[model samples]
Target: MRSFYNSETGAVSIYLIIILVPIFFLQAVLIDFARVKAAEREADTAARAAVRSVLSAFDTELQKYGLFGLTGEPESSESLFSMIYKENLSGSSSGGFYKLLDTKPEEGHASLTSLYTLANHTVFKEQILEHMKYTAPIEFVLEITDKLQKPGAVKTLANGSAYAKDAEKIEKLLVKREELLDRAWMETVKLKEELNGRHHTYRARITELNRLSELIGLNTADGVRSQIKTLEEQIRSLSDSISSLNGSLAAAAAAGPEAAAAIQGMMDNMRSLQDQLTELQRRLSDLKTLLDNIVKYTGLLAATKLEIVSDDEKVQNLQKSVQELLGEAKKANDELNTELKRVSSAAGNELKVFEAFKSLKILSEDDFRTYQTGIASSAAMFSGFRSGIGSINLFTNANAQKIHAANDAYQAQMDEIYQKQLVIETERNKRNETIRKEKEKQRSKIQAALDRARQAMGDCGTDQTAGSVSAFYETLEGKDGLYGKYMTLNESPSNAGGSPVYDLEGKPDTEIQHAMSLLERLGQTGESIRNELFVNEYALSLFNYRTYGREVDGSGQPKPLHAMSEPSGHKLPGQEVEYLLYGFNSCAKNRSSAYGEMFAFRFAVRMVEELMDPKNELLQAGSPLLVLLVSAAEAAVKALADMDSLTDGKAVPISSKLTNPLFTFTYKDYLRIFLLLHSSDTNLLARLQSLIELNTERTLDHAVTYIQGSAESSVSLWFLPGVMKLMNGTGISSCEVRENRCRFISRADLAY
Candidate 1:
């Protein structure tokens, strides 16, 4: 053996044996590793098959709604997975490099690791979208959406609310203007009374002036003549006294010697001379008295001049008062007309201003000129009377012609003054009557308009029986054309509350609240086209609505409707989609809520369409506010009618005009659009599951949509039994193989 070890003859064979033995061990190890890797690959294949098999057992009821959820409990899922896993890995026994000692999956290893229920929002939405890909009416939904998003669509809807507010504001403005007119009328009435009083004063002053003229002329002549007569009498007495004194002096000188002697005895020689001087002085004194009487007559003529001056002053004052009164009357009339014009303009009755006050010009230029001429004539008459009377003498013919001319002038001036003043009075009466009648008419018109506006705003009930608003209605009817009756719904007392009814009885407030919150968010964020179409298709397919039985399909188009039998004893059988929309437990409440929201949306869209019509004069000559309100009211009525027909399984045209090739929508079509509008909303899956569970006896406690599966196995190592045993001792088995597979099974991938 030592020599063989040393010798080269068999050395190479020994060395080759040693090298081949180690190489064979390494090759065996490599083969075992290769077998382990193969087992792992098979495990992976098994896990994938197991998960797919578990997904294949989907809930059939859910599948009817175009949704997918794993059926059965977790244990059942594990059992199904284990069975599939074992089948996939099962091979010919004892035929390969490794013996199939046990094909059974490891205990606790064949499991569904992850699960997503139908309640999962993402899973539910994905399934619906997948289902909708083939069935959604893309062209139709896009058409409706385009119409709703037209130019000024949102502005038009906003204008409806603004219209209501503006109607109320206009009503208030009309009321205030009416009150202002009333106050103005009272003021005008007082001004009219004052003007009439001034006229009366003018007439009275004219009469008094005429009387004073006569009195001054007559009394002045009489008094001056009487005084002149007295003066003449004194002059005559003085002349007689002068003659008597001369005669008496002659008799005393010639006839009475004894008397002369006695008189002489009473006086000396100087006394006789003094007696002659005294007789001459008496004659001179009588002459002086005659001249003084003449002077007194002249003074009486000057006093007559004073009377004429006083009479002229009175005439001037009367003329001034008349002028002032006329001015005041004119000013009052102007103010009244101004107020009338303002109120009429505000009431949209500008032409009424002209019609009402056309003949109410109180003091025209011609009337003022006539008054001035009359006043001037009266002054001239007074001046003539004063001049003629002041120069009157004792003879009746002395100033008779002048007095006659003055009297004639007085008569002519009085006649002219009376005629002109009568004209003024007549005009004043006309103005006053016109103002009174117009005040009543304007008040009635304003009050009526205000009442109509208030009725539109729900501030007051309409008084349909009072007043004649047939013209107003007719005008509105012409403007609205075919939609007139519907537009006038707000004009009725019963429909005063307007649109969007919010009766919340027997409804879950929390659910509705969440639904509304979701709707609000969706409105802000908007829905994707894909999501919108999916929701439309899903709502139309799975739920029974008002006209569910009337659905029919045309070739090459989506089914117009889905037929469904009404479920018995369900809270909402025919209104399942409405419940989904509003989340109400009560069927009636859900229907009401759905109807209200539908009506509101339809009304808004219709209002925009109506406002866009160029022939509608609401934005121009009429109140934009009224147009908006009437459009809403029209849409409400038309929508109700449309709903009636739609629920009766008939299609109604979208536009009131019913244009050629009309775009029509049935109840389900409208519901589809409603779903599209609220695609991201609905907080829906939970409520849907609740309804499904409520309708069925089985509980969908944990319906799964997504799942992760694991499969593990132990394979016998053919070339390394001792090593495998050693590895198993350290909890590191060389025969161990594990594989994991994850899957998200949805309606899109629900293939068996």
Candidate 2:
């Protein structure tokens, strides 16, 4: 190489230079090529970053308005997009790699679309749009759907509205039940007071009769007769009093069937207990009179002993009175024996108090059964809803807890109001207070959202259907638009009177209205309010027909007649009504088809069946009330032992007979004993009142449970479905850019 450059080899060096010239020239051209390529790559990167920035703006606006742009609230899509593009373009257009005109209008242009035609929203459109220097046009399309159904905005909204309405219905039923319980509690109080008064009277009579009792022995005839006559008069008065009490009791039973049945049970116990005491008193009075008269005659005989041999007319009269009194004593003793036998008979005469107890047992048991059945369906609905809505993640578990608590609080208030002995107005008042508060909370949330929308979009009135980007896209694409079929599917149902309009694009205010509907339904809950849990309303109607013994018309509504137990053609599994009456056929009815009637009629029939049982065990032993009555009887027996003149085993037989009747004192005797033992135990009445208060509370709890369950299910059924449809279709997307990096939202997140 040194020789080639040396002047000694000048001729050879000149030839080498000629050869190197072409190589050096080629190397310089390659170097310039590398620089140009590097410039192009940098320009491409800047353009990608700028376009991505603009896309982020679009995403923000689209998210605010709902990806489908169906939120009837205005959005700042166009203005924000324009501003973001200007900022991004100006910032990235620097670095001197490419040229971009700073002039307005024709100098800068952008086309946004779902990709149907060039003429639509097109400044330019091609596989690679012309005159779009250094980059390719970026395009993205949103396709929302629900694979579960006709997944789209319209279907989602429609289902949501239906679910919301159904939830309202369930909530209303809870409120209705509370009102019914209140009424029942009031009636219970009235019945308790009346029966308690009768009980007190019977107790007093028992005490007086015991004081009059003594063993069969002897006494003066005139004094004995006078005492006997007074006793008989008192006994007759008691009988008349008892008869009047029974009449009043019957009137009390004429109240609503549910209350009447419960009240009637107490009345029967009171009556039977009173009768046992009355009979016992009558027998004891007879024995006392016979014993006193016998003692008097024996005394006269003793006094006449010294004068007996001489025939005095007075002595003859005294002798005759003694014999007559003796005969009466024997007869009285025989009658007492006979009455004791009947009182001891457990199967034939039947223990009186037990008969009343049986009715109560059956009624209470049946009521519980009804309650369980009612709640079971709603509970299932809630479970399903909870699962479904969990996926939607908009309505939270906390929201469910709050919603259920509101209903429970409303019921609790009803209990307090009823305890105040308030009437129907109290029911209305409680509803108003709770519902208003809940509604206010809903309204406040809606207001906050609306205020935010106003701040963002100015005074664009939340009906953005006209100037909205969504509308523009639809108009641009028309029948062949990417979302044309979705739009058609989401169209609203025809208007129903007094219902809110359904335009697919829900207004911001619509959320508030839905909340109001929920409160109204909850407030409207009553005895008449019915629901079909885990099934459609129409299906519930069919279930009712099968369970309630209804005949169905062609239209599938139940047609009930006055006579119940008519066989319905259909049968649902495990329904007692179906087994008894043939089948329940309708969801609701005018008179005999109601739930109260269903139970009332069945219990009434069962009451008769139990009363006819020979065992006298209908009182189905083992209750706090029964134990109290029996204990009272034992006290009476003890008091008899403490009584004057009756302690020398003279009253032992009577006490033994009463305490050990049928190997144990019968319910009748027990009831008599209870009245006598705790005559002043006012706390008994107070305890019973507590039970009465529970009537409404128990009902309200069950109702609230059902409502909450249905509400949760409805959110899944109505609200979450809309979003899920979007997730299945629109949330998933793909794009390939020939000369650009596509900037787009890859995930759909919502906070509704």
Candidate 3:
């Protein structure tokens, strides 16, 4: 029993079974797991790569065709999957795999099927298909299958089986031929349809051409009539103008001498009147002096009572002085009357010249009416001409269509000729194949015969027998007979000749070339379209610029203000004025000091307004500081204006004071005070007060400290101290001393 248990075979068998079974199971499990993992990874990678590849292809196609932003069903997910399928097939090296896969649509989901078959020769095959179905909330499904084969399995196939290969080749060739024939037939049909359409168009073109010709003739006749009418009207207008000029010349000649004589007479009478008035003025001066002296003497007499006896002499002198003044006045009045008569006569002569001018007819109402009528008639004629041109265009287009139709028909004929040539080439190839087969059979038969003859000549011993046998062999081989003939046949060119060339030089034959020439003509047509489009764009730009009241000024800069209408009639603040000021400042700031200063003044005023309104957006945005700097520029303009006003008597007192440097200094102090009082920042207020004190000798320390402590402090503290210092330092009495003193003293110790 011990021997049996310890036996080598049984013990070894038990050990082998126990170890091999578990190992084999583990190996199989691992292999399957690895294969499944690899398949899953491959499927995920391929899905992502395929999606990317499809999207890339779609983008490329869109860019090439300039069809960006064009969306349709072709771009949908289902369409993308279809495209991917086709693309994969096209790129695939193995044919069976693609054909085995099925991609189909279901009710609400896409279904894709893939098959994988593994053979025992280490050969692997895989098929993958993807499908997408439905539009709303699109769904997709993918099916993948993999097949693996063990190595060396392929060598087990049966041999001597050429039938399958030959049959496949023949079937493929037949299918190719059928496809080619279908394509050729479709192209031919399309050509025929196009030719028919072109023929119809050509017939219409001929009718249009005839209409255009008629229109041309009518236009020529009407144009000539219009020219003649224009000439007649111009001649009549010239005649009327010349007649009026002649009438005016005659009237001027009649009035010329009388007008000159009257003017001269008036001048002489005015000289006499001037002399009498001068004499009267001298006598009146003497009387006025005497009256003044008498009033002085009377006042003196009232105080001294100085009297003279026999005052008749003095009275007579006074009376004589008065009479002389009266006589001089009378003479002056008579001279004025004579001058008035002469002046009236001269005025009458001038009226005669005016009457002559009034009677002349340079531009008549009838002439104006005729001119307007001509303009209207011209516009109507132009409209008719445009219509005629349009008709001509239609006629020419119809003719072009007819020409195209003829060309297309010729193209069809050429295509038929080419097809016949292909047929001939096919027949020639068949003939060559038959010849090759016959030669091959003949060679085989000759070889067999030589082998039999060699057997017959064996063991024979005679030069003649050997020679005869050799000769027979040579004859059988056709070395000097049929063989040579076969060689010659092989060396010769084919019996069939080259294809015939179509004659394109003749009138009807040229039509084919004309149709082909459309490719080149299209380039010229495109160029013409581009030129017309450019002209249209230019015209549109010009029209828009003009209508918008925008144009370039003398300096080649856009001057929007110049284009704007005048603002005299405008009720609101004119945009033109604002534009002018803004534009001028933009230009003048860089180049002109005078204009820069003016703009600065406006900017300062705007700043002041913003500062006064604390709620103003611009002020809150910190524009007041900029406004203050801008306002400072007003000092220069004000100074110049003040100088001008003082020298030329044009300056108002209020303007002079405002523009004075003292007022500017005072205003700056007031601004600082206001900013300090209203500012929420204590640090800014202290800094501003320090700045104001440093710049000017004004004392703002007290006002600044009070404002820093109390938000309710009045800005009057800033102005009053400065005003008191100004008055005391300048040593000039105030306009109203009491009021000035009260303003300064009342606010002296006031704080918030």
Candidate 4:
């Protein structure tokens, strides 16, 4: 008790201790307040981010609504704002205080209820926000509002905006449609090509079947079946031809005037042949009925035939090769089917993208309807490749089957013939022994007959005009001496009595004799030798890169029509069409679809100029070009006007827009005629006609050879006075044919 009373020094320490407690508590209160403030700031930041994200969802919808003076976005199946919130902030971020709030919700709720229970103390709750864990219960409302606009102005804006969107979509659709249509047209062309090829195969098959039928004797079982197959093939061929003709008619109609005329002519021809077609159809129907009846009795035919087979090595080899081919073709068919499936899947995806655009409702419903239709048609055409390939497979299989059946039938026929001979073999052998002896006695006389044969005939029968195969091919390809219409024009009725006396063959002959004749015939016509070239002026400049292909290097060729500074050099030989050129007369050229009119135009102008030149020296030399156009004033112009003629179309009268200062020229009338010819559409009828003409078909204008110092080059430059269609297996770039048997040639090789 005395020591405790001595610690008066401890009293001041107690007072200091008591003062430190309040100071410590005050420091803790400041730290906790800082925590609450920081949490609130973090929560505010997250709220802003979440609200901003949700606001973005309204842009497109807002655009639509705002433009129309609407208060809000259009109703959608899903809540855009909720979607944005989940995507942007809360659900995924799970904003716990470390996230959005300071304490766990259950813990914070218990503490807040006991310590700060009243809504009146929500401010007190923020003071303790650090103790909270999540903001889920304390919802953050994010309003995405837009400024309102005048109703009338919004309507106008919406109309403008929707129209702009629709217009853009329509434009894109139109471009796509155009591309698809082009592809469709190309596919249509390919389809036609396939059909034509099929027609040829069908023809060959029919012929082969007929030959086999004849060999087996037409009255027999195999023969009758072969005949039925041939008739069916004929029916198929007729049907295919009719389909091809329909395409041909459509193409010709769109080709231009010349083809239009050809279309009319074809229509007229069809009218003439309608009855024949009806009869053919009737015959086909009857044949089908007959075929069905024959097929129904097939079990009876199989019963009469034994298992005998032909021992012919040729047939056996062909059958074996065909079987191997069928095996390979099957593999290829499988691969093609797989590729086609992939193509189908790709097409489906493309349709989905198109449908996606449609769902936006930004395109004019009616405006793009045509595009869909066109796309469907184009898709159909492209898909036709599947059918084309399938048909080829079918044909190949049919051919293999035919070969197998024919072999079996051949064996049966041989066996039947041999069976009869077997019954009398012993008697024939005894008779042959006596006959052999008699023949041996007369063997010396046989030498005299052999000697006479050797004396009369040379070795190997060498006097044939041409190979049988070659002759047959030539006949089938329509090359048996028909001339092109260009060379067949009679101009004058008086000369219609006979053909021209030109001694020319189809080959490129450059013998000294032919050169002399051509040189004399085409000798410098009047003023051509006196022609001068203005190499330094614009005269030659105009033709520098021009496609005249005419050698103007001091040659006696026609000067390019564009060398306008020198007006007196003859025009493209056409009287008024002096500037129209051969190479430049492209159907692909600006404002033109064909060059045949250009050819006829050249012919007409040259003819008129020749007659009216007042300076043409060729008139005295009995000019052939002029003679060919002797009826130019009447028949030539009439031919151009006639829809049935294979040249060009009628000329139009030159109007005001096309009036020229040069119209006052002496040949202005002919110029007007030329203008009319150029303006008029000349369809591909003439070119197609020329292209399909046979090699032996005499050309209208130039002959096969031209003078190059007597060195002839085989070229088919079809742009001159005598261009003709190039024929198969002969052109410079033509592919070689590889058939073992004689095959008909086609003129589709006329690319040049």
Q: Candidate 2, which segments miss by more than 4 Å at Cα?
A: 1-153, 209-752
lDDT of 3 by residue, 561-621 (tens): 3211122222111111111111111111211222222222222222222222233332222
Kindly give the stretch of ten consecutive residues in candidate 2 with the minimal lDDT sum: 705-714
| Tens-digit per-residue lDDT, 261-287, candidate 4 | 789877776654555556666766665
Models sorted by TM-score, best on top: 1, 2, 3, 4
Q: What's the distance in Å from true for residue 619, model 3?
A: 20
Q: lDDT by residue for model 2 over 1-752, one digit each (tens)?
A: 77565657477787899999888755654443333333333333433443343334322222211111111111233333334434433223444532322211112233222212111112111111221122211110011011112223222222223323322332243334344444444443443342334234323432332233222223445666677667677677767767777776777777767677767676876778587657758775775757664655444434333222231233233323433433343344344334333334534333233233222211133443333232233223323333332332122344434434432332343334334434533654574465555445544543443343223211212322334433433322244432222222223221111112111123323432332333233223232211111011111222222223323333556445331112222222212121112111211111122222222111222222222322333134322122222222233223322221111111111222212211221111212222222222122212111111121111111111000000000001112223233333453422111121212221112111
Per-candidate local distance difference test: 0.49, 0.30, 0.29, 0.29
Q: What clash count goes with each model?
A: 1, 38, 13, 20
- The top-ranked prediction according to lDDT is 1
- The alpha-carbon deviation from the true structure for residue 95 of candidate 1, after best TM-score superposition, in angstroms, is 5.1
Name the weakest run of 10 consecutive residues (lDDT summed) in model 1. Answer: 740-749
